[model samples]
Target chain A: AQTVTQSQPEMSVQEAETVTLSCTYDTSESDYYLFWYKQPPSRQMILVIRQEAYKQQNATENRFSVNFQKAAKSFSLKISDSQLGDAAMYFCAYIPNFGNEKLTFGTGTRLTIIP
Target chain B: DVKVTQSSRYLVKRTGEKVFLECVQDMDHENMFWYRQDPGLGLRLIYFSYDVKMKEKGDIPEGYSVSREKKERFSLILESASTNQTSMYLCASSLVTGGWYNEQFFGPGTRLTVL
Candidate 1:
């Protein structure tokens, strides 16, 4: 069984500034995948970034990046140059390498971008 | 672009009524999942199918059942709608790359209200 945790229930970031959303997971598997998903007010869940356990390098999208520490089971999402469009509910998710590809998600963190 | 579509954006059903939620994916992915999103509980997986007729129970499956009769379509069924089951239901699909490294694409969730 796997569980993901996002400590921050709500986060606020000023436009053009940077913000980090914390996430931690407990998994027994050595190889798995971590993902960060953003759900805006439109109610669509968009993939922000993904990180593989074997790869030490964190994943980075245009304005989204992750700090994945395999040892600590921490995979925090960093939003750089935060924009108004970034305001959403962010979820940290996990998927193991085998069996069904069901995702285990953490309690979301609602992010508010302030101008 | 990978497009996952759900049948309804919002639905209202009376308690004890049978409910059906449909999902379709255009990307021909081999995996589909059903999840419910509550305010503080995040996304809890109800069911997932790796292939047609192959289904697996997820963390929270007592109140839901699923069907994957085709590669691109999946359905979630509520035998009897209950107030506690009212929430945002999400459908997601992913290409199976033989493991868990595949990325999942989500649909604009279906908001179900049981009255």
Candidate 2:
């Protein structure tokens, strides 16, 4: 079974600054997908960024980027130019290339945007 | 835009009560998932359906059953609710293209409390 770990339970970043949330996973599969999801208070959860294990380049989406280290089995999310909208619970997820594509999520990190 | 809606935003039930949580998705997605979120545990998949009338148990399917008579709707049922079942329930949908899974869109979670 694959397991994702997010050690930080809470993180805070000042407005317009940058914050990084750490994540690591245990997986024997060489090919898989990793994802970061954000869930705001009483709002829908949305995808932040995704990284493919086979792709060496990290994935970037707007102000959100991921540091995917396949060799170290680490995948961290970096939020730049942080805004108030970034305050939410961030989750790291893993899914293999095969099977039912069920996601295994880490214990979330609650991000607070300090203004 | 893809939209997944749950039947209730909040629910309170008594122990031994039969509870049903309904989820409906738009955009004709082929896969729908049910998950429970806790404080220290991110999201644990309870069940998922790939097609109409076809359902699969996820990582944490114990004490839960699912029904998917239609492609757009999936229902999670707790035959006898317990205090341990109190948690936030989330519904998500994703597309399967060429045997690969796409990004999942989530609904505003339902917070259920069992007394």
Candidate 3:
């Protein structure tokens, strides 16, 4: 079974600054997908970024980017020019290339944007 | 815009009561999932349906059942609600493109309280 771990339970970043949330996972599969999701208070959970294991290049979307290290089994999310709207609970999830198409998620990191 | 909506944002129920949580997606996705979120635990999959009347047990399916009579709607049922079952329930939908899966779109979530 694959397990995702988010060591940081809470993270805070000043407005307009940058923040990085750490995540690690255990999986033997060579081809898979890693994802970062954000859930704001009383709001829907949305996809932040995604990285494919076969792709060496990291994934970037707007202010959100991912540092995916396949060898280390590490996938981290970096938020640049953070704003108050970035304050939310962030989760790291994993899914393989094949099979049931279910996601395995980490415990999550609560991000706080300090103004 | 792709939208997945839950029946309620907040629900209160007593122990042993039968609870049903409804989810509907406007995107005509082929896959739908149900998950539960807790403070220290990330989103745990409870059940998922690939097609109408085709359901599969996810990571945690105990005390929970699901129904997918229609392509756009999926329902989760708690045969006997318990305090341990009180948590935030989330519904998600995604498409299967050429045997590959796409990123999931989530609902706002329903917070259920079992007293």
Winning model by lDDT: 3
Q: Write the per-residue lDDT of candidate 3 for residues B32-108, one digit (tens) a residue.
A: 99999999999999999988999999999999999999999999999999999999999999996222356999999
What local lDDT does model 3 show for residue B82? 99
Cα displacement (angstroms), candidate 3, residue A104, comes to 0.5
Runs of candidate 1 exceeding 4 Å displacement: B97-101
Which stretches in model 3 have alpha-carbon errors above 4 Å? B97-100
Candidate 1 residue lDDT tens string, A49-104? 88889999889999889999999999999999999999999999888877555678
- The CAPRI-style docking tier of model 3 reads medium
lDDT, candidate 1, B1-115, per-residue tens: 9999999999999999999999999998988989999999999889989889999898899988998889999999999999999999999998984364478899999999999
Write the residue-wise lDDT of candidate 2 on B7-115 in tens digits.
9999999999999999999899999999999999889899988899998898889999999998899999999999999999999999972233568899888999999
Over 4 Å off in model 2, which ranges?
B97-100
- The lDDT of model 3 is 0.94
The lDDT values for all models are 0.91, 0.92, 0.94
- Which scores higher on TM-score, 2 or 3? 3
Which sequence of candidate numbers ranks them by TM-score, best first?
A: 3, 2, 1
Predicted candidate 2 versus true structure: per-residue lDDT over A3-114, tens digit per residue: 9999999999999999999999999999899999999988999988888888999999999999999999999999999999999999998888886667889999999999
